[model samples]
Target: MNTSKSAGEIRLIRLDRIEVLNPRERGSRVFEEIVRNIKTIGLKKPISVTPRIDASGAEKYLLICGEGRLKAYQALGEEEIPALVVDVPDEDAFIMSLAENIARRQHHPLELLSGIRQLLDRGYTIRSIAEKTGLNHCYVQQICNLLRMGEERLLIAVESGGIPINVAVTIAGAGDDDKAVQAALQEAYESGALRGRQLTLARRVIDKRQRLGRAAGRTSTTKHSHISTTTVIRTYQDEVKRQTALVRKAEFSQQKLLLVVGALRQLLCDENFVNLLRAEALTTMPKYLAERVWPNGSHA
Candidate 1:
């Protein structure tokens, strides 16, 4: 996070003056627990606040995080609370708040990734995103890479804990190369990271990518627009059967053509056959077969 524009100072601010720009709904039970904690142990962290001028040209503070704590303070009838004041844009403040929510594990896995993606979109450095989200730098970077390539399937798998991020990255980098993807999955399987149903899931995901593409459809996800296992299996089987039939037909045609070529080549070696063909004006053979029977276009 660009420190020059963030984490300015900690100061007391009126609770009524702070506007929760991106407030999340906390369960009643959770809210009560937070109130109890603050009452018993006092607030451990201060709320994050950024100043913005309203249409009336009056300065007001926007709450970036610490909603629970701020609420706890209000419940305790406290008029003012300590807030970490920062000077940043509304968008940056919102992203910071989202990162803080993710840090607390208050968001879905996809939401977490989306928040990281938003930060990356804002041109936040990987280290900066890691700092804001309280995530590992490598993890943030991996998420950025996955989002950049639009590896929606692998991203879903990663979020669902179906595969490792490294494995997903490997498979994604493999692109349309099935062999490379298979190799990457095989390595994951060998490492004991991917097994059993997850192994099957990995295969299916790769199969989906092969048949369709890496991107998930507009509204597709595991819960919605989900492709069934039987569907994927049937599709694979049908493709294999079609390909096998084509190869078999090609082989049969090649055998018949070779037999004809062999007989014609033998006839071309006979003086009578050559003379008879020359006399009948049906002497011209295809250049390919002629070259095959008579080396360097030489006549018998």
Candidate 2:
């Protein structure tokens, strides 16, 4: 981004004269808070804009950043607000705006990646975007290629933070090469980014894309989140834990049953106790007990 020749000088501009080049959708709660903050403390940093002359020879200011502050001023019934004027081309101005928006706060991984995709869709070169956004040139290239290939499974994994960007890149770079995919999974597993279940997930996703093609893969992949690469591994881990607990409980019950049956069989084998029970008129046994103790149907 080019530094302003104005050198921090703030100029007051009318609200009507400023036009936002790209209007972003902000939640009402956030917008209201912006309005409240400006009302209470006033504008801390001046909004940035560029002077543009329309084809009709009318001049208007193209807003490069600070739409929130601009809108807050309007809601506050203010006619003019301070702005920092910049002289740059439209694309540079837009990139500058995007950089500021991204740098303002931590963004959700999906939102940040989608924003980069939006810039790519706008025909900006990967190197230019990397330079402007302070991202690794290679990383930006990989992201552009992955998004271009419509590899939503890998992207969703990255977006969900289940897998890191580098891991996703590794998987996407494989692209129909089974050996490469296996190598990528091995790398992820060794690096601790992927566990056994996650490795399984990565393989399934790659296999689907390879078998059904990207269109079908994306369709089936999204309809059910249980199969999604992001949540599937965790879900499988939870299920494994539950199954192990059930098996342990079953084994415990089996042991207790064996102990009870052993004690009963031993007591029944004693002639003195058997004769005593008979004398007490207790010859009949429950059918289930008889079936277990004497398998030949001999109750006494």
- List per-prediction Cα lDDT, in the order shown: 0.81, 0.77
Candidate that scores best on TM-score: 2
> Model 1, 208-258: lDDT tens per residue?
776556677664445333555656777899999999999999999889878
- Give lDDT tens digits, candidate 2, residues 156-224: 666555667788887888776878888888888988988776677777767666544543333544334
* Model 1, runs deviating above 4 Å: 1-16, 21-32, 39-42, 71-82, 87-99, 102-107, 127-135, 159-161, 174-183, 196-300
- The TM-score of candidate 2 is 0.57
User: For all candidates, what are the clash counts?
Assistant: 0, 0
Each prediction's TM-score versus the true structure: 0.53, 0.57
